[model samples]
Target: MKKYLGEGLLIVFSVLFALFINSLAQKYQTSQKVKVAKESLLKEMEQNQVIMTQWKEKHSKILKHIDEIIKNDSLQEELIKDHFLDIGALTGQENLISSLVTSTAWETAQATQILSELDFDTTQELTYVYELQNSIINSTLPDLVDIYFQRETHRKESLLPTLIQFKLHFNEIVGQETLLVTLYPGAIEKLQD
Candidate 1:
């Protein structure tokens, strides 16, 4: 009876040890995954921040030009007299400032369920930044394009109105970009930590 009791004790200990080892291995794997995900997210966010800054500067310049044209009656008259022929020449082509901003890493992390592994604050901040980016890409940009492409039979009559609408959209996009530029560093720091 004593021998049987010893054997039973040994078997129980062996099983417990195996389970502990498996649990530790799983934890190590998870940590490694989190590290890789953080690295990818950091790199992607850095690239996006650079792009947003560049576009923000471009949009700011365009906004300034729009303000100048709107404030000065002579400038408006010159544009109107020319039938707005030099409008595109005055303000660089709209398409030139509309470069594609990417969010592939953020999207991939979401799709793969890796964001669940990230800390709550980091995830929340990243979501906010990406949502703003999506807003710019999906909504603001399309509205700007629509306004630019909308036909006007009398360019002189429509110049002021078109400039006003363009100013509104550009102002919105620049504000969003500025917010994104500000948010990016915090997100990157969290990821690095």
Candidate 2:
């Protein structure tokens, strides 16, 4: 009876020890996954920050030009005349709204369920950023702005309402981008921690 008891105890201990090791391994694997996903997200955010900075710079100039058009009749006339005479000066600014901010890593993490492994706060922050990115990418505001820009350029007519609409949409996107800029550092810090 003593021999049987000892054997039973040994078997139970061995099973428990195996389970503990397996649990530890699983935890380590999860930690590594979280680290990789976080690093990918941080890198993605860094790229976005750079893109956003460029966009802001370019758009600042475009917005200044738009302001000049709205405020100075002579400038509007000049731009319209220039636009018609085979001058491609404003081409870059005209296509300003067409740039898409991508979030490929975020999408990949979402698809792979890596986001679930992250802490709640980090996940929420990323969700917000990605949502803003999606909003920008999926927006029809750029199309509307392009059409309005074409009309203004071709007709040389005063389309204050159309320009106002474009400005409003553009400002909305800028505001979202600003919020993303604010959120990224905190998210990156949390991920590193």
Candidate 3:
């Protein structure tokens, strides 16, 4: 009877050991999956930040044009509102994007308020272009032009081209800037204006 009792105790210990080993294996697999998911998220965040930085740099180049439009006496308040809206868009601020998408609306509402004081029709395509050009000339369009060209060249040469290049192309037409600046007006001439 003592011998049987000893054998039964050994069997119980073996079963517990097997369960502990299985639990350890499961924990290890779960930890690995978590690490991999974290790495992928970090990579995605880094890539998005890079693209946003590039977009902001490009927006800086075209501020002059935007300013020119804002100052136009003939421009409608509605047109200026749109200009402000687009300008707010270039910043890629989280709060701004959230508000605009989920009931936050752009900080451009301030500009829109100022715009509401004036009365003019902004729907005509030709007038809209002229106002937009004027606003952009005074705004930071030059910076954007430089950034766009830089990225375009980088894309043409690099192998690991990101979807960012395609994203930039999809954004609204701000201005038609050839990748080559020398072929266009010198930056010095723009500053002189």
Candidate 4:
């Protein structure tokens, strides 16, 4: 009877040890997934931040040039009289900024179910940032197309107000993007640590 009891105890211990090893393996796999997801997210965030900063700088410079032109009564009269042909000279053919936002990492993480492994707060913040990016892209499309047509058609007086209005809207979007970029670094660092 004592020998049987000893054999039973050994079997139970072996089973428990196997379960522990399995748990550790599962934990390690999960940690690796989280790390990969975090790295991908960090890369995407950094890229978006850089692109937003560049866009903001370019937009501000263009707006400044436009403001200067509009503030000068003489220039405004010249543009008005000449039908704003010089606006093309000032703004150039490439005035419309293309969207530089990317969502591949986010989409991949979602499709692979890795996003669920990320922290709740991090997921929420990422969602908010992407949503803002999408909004900025969609909102600016019509204005950009309008600017293109205006420039192409040389509709000076009409284009000026439209450009000014678009600039205002662009500034608001840039402000929101800047705020998101500012907040992203800290969150990424925390996750990395």
Which number leads on lDDT?
Answer: 1
lDDT of 4 by residue, 1-193 (tens): 9999999999999999999999999999988988888788888878887787777776666666667765776655564576654544445434546557787888888898888887788787788777777776776645555654565435654755754665675567557667766766765665575
Show how many residue pairs clash in every candidate, following the order shown: 0, 0, 34, 0
CA deviation > 4 Å runs, candidate 2: 82-100, 140-154
Work out the TM-score per prediction. Answer: 0.86, 0.80, 0.37, 0.72
TM-score of decoy 3: 0.37
Model 2: per-residue Cα lDDT over 62-169, one tens digit each: 555556565866655665574451123332335664455678888888888888888899888778777876776666445544655464535545445444554565
lDDT of each: 0.83, 0.68, 0.36, 0.70
lDDT of 1 by residue, 35-146 (tens): 8888998998998888899899988888888899989878777655755435464365554365667888888889888899998999999999899999988998888777
Per-residue lDDT of 55 in model 2? 65
lDDT per residue for candidate 3 within 1-193, as digits (tens), equals: 9999999999999999999999999878666654443343334334433433443345444343344333553432433244222323333332211210010111232223322322233112212332343343333345434553553423322311322332343233223222212211222222122
C-alpha RMSD (angstroms) for model 3? 23.1
Arrange candidates by lDDT, highest first: which order?
A: 1, 4, 2, 3
Pick the TM-score winner.
1
